[model samples]
Target chain A: MTGLNNKIHQALQQIHAEQALKDKTKAALKQKIQQYEKQKYKTEKRRLVAILACLCLLLIGGAGWFYFTPATTISIDINPSLEVGVNFFDRVVSVESYNDDGQELAASLDIRFMTYAQAIQEILETENITDLLSADEILTISVIGSDEQRCRRILSDIESYTAGQKNIYCYSAASDEVATAHEIGLSYGKYRAFLELQSLDPDITPEELQHMTMREIRDLIDSLSGNKQNENASDTHQGAGNGHGQNSGGGNRRQGR
Target chain B: MRSEQEVNKAIERYADTVRRLCMIYLKNETDTEDIFQTVFLKYVVSSVSFENEEHEKAWLIRVTINACKDVLKRFFRSHTISLNELMEQPEILEPDHTEVLEAVLSLPLKYKDVVYLHYYEGYTAPQISRILRKNVNTVYTLLTRSRQLLKEKLGGDGLE
Candidate 1:
């Protein structure tokens, strides 16, 4: 009888689980849509602001090289490159570059915390930036934290993964981690970090993960997320970021070069 | 008397339970998740005052069920179902009898609701009545009739 009961039980339970997972996926998709919409909204507002600012300037128009204005660029040369941590909850990254010419270039940010698939999907296929970005889309390109999950990355039990190390995880670019709609949300960066660690230390035993704090394991993983030598500004995602967000402030800004 | 710690603990402990319940009630994936989100959101917003931990949990469950009911209505009206299907097993569960499961899903939403709460969740008839706000007699009768129909459809032994 228990066996018979078990059959019905499993079916219903399976259905229940399926529904929840499906719900999570759909909610995430919807969240991404909303984020994109918001980015557009912010961009529109900024454009309007620029237009208003320009109109006032035009009203008092002057025709000289000094009067003509190019974009503002202030090159903040960060020395001793800072390693900002991308934790398990971060979703987006943006970079701002300024040169002496007052010309500003919003360089590509370190967004490698995102899966190649997801990055492709968002950067290429998707058009709505508002939903993917925040209302405070740094116009001058503040260093974007695409994979906030990296900062919060944890070393899961070794038995959980294929090899040895825990995976880097990131939350959705679609939803706000601090203000998500669902009780549970996806960690895209930490999740991938988990996988990548396993691949590196395929023989990483489970016992090594039993008692250590996440902060401790992050020490070992700080060198593996990307090539240590890829220091160009456009190459932010190519190296393992140190576990300190603030310490890397100056150096992270240089990642856009 | 639950302290602040106890309230937090209860939320952590029963999170899985509420998630499972929402899933069972709202068969559609989006509906189940939306219900779960609404439950937690309302819980967080309403935490301004609380008598005890039980009150908090009860509030969460009641809101979850009500929210699930709301989602089911919207889903039936919109008729958009089966988006990104993935199963979430409880800590431990039994094997699925596919035919029987199909027969069960085919029942009217009301009958299906009662059946899931009873068999899947292992709730009593009275419990189902309370959850659904139906009379116990009505719940009991629905169970019997639904079980009979299920047995007839799936050639079951018909004993619950």
Candidate 2:
């Protein structure tokens, strides 16, 4: 067996793999490796594209939220009571109507995306508003917001724009007061008048006042307060002589006639 | 995956041992080529780190043995080959060495690996057990049986 083991070792020693076999294997391995690298690169590129697509969607969604969110509200109250929501860029983002007449006016007007000043000028030039102003009907504009400085700036701009107009009033009120006004289905301007009327005539209901124009509410408040005798004296002053202050919880009336 | 340089070095180092194992298990050159490609490809893709050259050699031996077994177990394989076809360089071997190699290859499949690993490779029973993943006593029994079979086939003139 020992001699046989020696013979076996010498015999096996003569059997080595040919150089041709090793060359063939190396060529096959190189080809397979190249294919593997190409497959890996394609998979990585697909993953990168998916990530970029998700990032673009997130950026577009964020920009949409920033552009559409309202930062303040401007309520224009007359026979047509409605509010225009203004974004941080001073553009009108929304217009919400509180009455049938307001809804008609809102439907007829295309004031969205316009600057607040342009929207207000558009509203004042409308036939309904021009006719009402000539007939001595009162138009009240209220600026509603959480930021005091922005509200004051908006109110000053509004007052300057309507300086020559008669029977128009502007004021600033806080967001909490506007929230209370919305609860009873009223614009902030009409809600302020309701509060004044409720103080003078405790029997005056919001339901009764909802259909009434701003002039009618003012006359009812004057008759209830016994100030009808001073009505002509108040009308003599065009856009001055009305109380304009920072009203934290109520209307700071900027102009009245 | 291993670099081409590393794979080349491994092929140069272990090709002989692998060829010997392939000859002992699979007698045909086609099956030997299959086992060669499979075993080297496995080495290229494997991430296992070796502690020493001996460890790497043992791993290659174990992989080659398993690859040969898988080829042999295939249902469509042509299992028979003459001794002349089996030897790539039959003209180089003397008659005595040819007789010894024939006797070694004629053993049953179970005894061939133990005989080759023990006699030619000089692996102990315990080392063969570790390489083949079998019990030490089983390796010892296989070695003793294979020696008895070889002695029976060849004359006992130079037997231990």
Interface RMSD after interface superposition, each candidate = 7.1, 1.7
Which one is best on lDDT? 2
Worst lDDT 10-window in candidate 1 chain B: B78-87
Q: Model 2, residue A254: displacement in angstroms? A: 5.2
Worst 10 residues of 2 chain B by lDDT: B75-84
TM-score, every prediction: 0.34, 0.74
Q: Please state the Cα-based DockQ of model 2 relative to the true two-chain complex.
A: 0.57
Indicate the docking level reached by candidate 2: medium
Give residue B25's error in model 2 in angstroms.
Answer: 4.0
| TM-score of chain B taken alone, every candidate | 0.64, 0.93
Chain A accuracy as TM-score for every candidate: 0.18, 0.81
Best by TM-score: 2
Output the lDDT of residue A95, model 1. 22
